[model samples]
Target: MTANTSKSTEGAHEPGGFGALRRLHLSYAGEVQGVGFRWASKLTAERVGCTGWVRNEPDGTVTQELQGTPDQIATYFGAFSRVFAAHPIEYVIAEKSDISPIEDERLFTVRF
Candidate 1:
């Protein structure tokens, strides 16, 4: 995982700190690659002030883990869903895991 610095967005919710961080590891399937998904996700995470990582999986799914406050994290996921809906790129199958908090994360970026 890498650290990125981003300015908070207007009305953007953020977690307090490591203790407040909530984690969500998701598997995104269905035409998830080669469509700037990671880039778009970076923007999404930044908007909601989530700290974690999102990367492409070998199984053609976009994998991401996010840590943040409950509200902020949920807002992030909601925006993410809305983005996919508006973009309408192929299929946007996805599965999410439990939420957990993580420390030492600063910004969101596309992981290699």
Candidate 2:
């Protein structure tokens, strides 16, 4: 896990200020690829006001790097998990790592 060096004073609940932002690297395995996981993750991140990217790995995993407040990040994950559960996509959290937050992120996107 990288150190949290965010200097922004914006609170997590604030509209534009990503208060106490953090970055997370997450990988999902087991039927994650080709299951609309990346698209669903992108939607969840956008809805939660997170900035980062998700992609499909060649090893049949779905990998994503997301940046947001702790609560927002949790919410994003919850949303994704709910979708997976409802649809039964065989998704499993394989790994997670905390990373240094990028200071100037403006939007969440999906990377191919």
Best by TM-score: 2
- C-alpha lDDT of all candidate models, in order: 0.69, 0.75
Candidate 2 clashing pairs, residues 3+ apart or interchain = none
TM-scores of all predicted structures: 0.71, 0.79
Question: How does candidate 1 fare on TM-score?
Answer: 0.71
Candidate 1: stretches off by over 4 Å? 1-19, 90-94
Candidate 1 residue pairs that clash: 4-107, 21-101, 22-68, 23-100
lDDT of 1 by residue, 47-72 (tens): 98887888998878888877777778
Clashes of 2: 0
lDDT of model 2 at position 77: 68
Candidate 1 weakest ten by summed lDDT: 1-10
Q: Best candidate, lDDT-wise?
A: 2
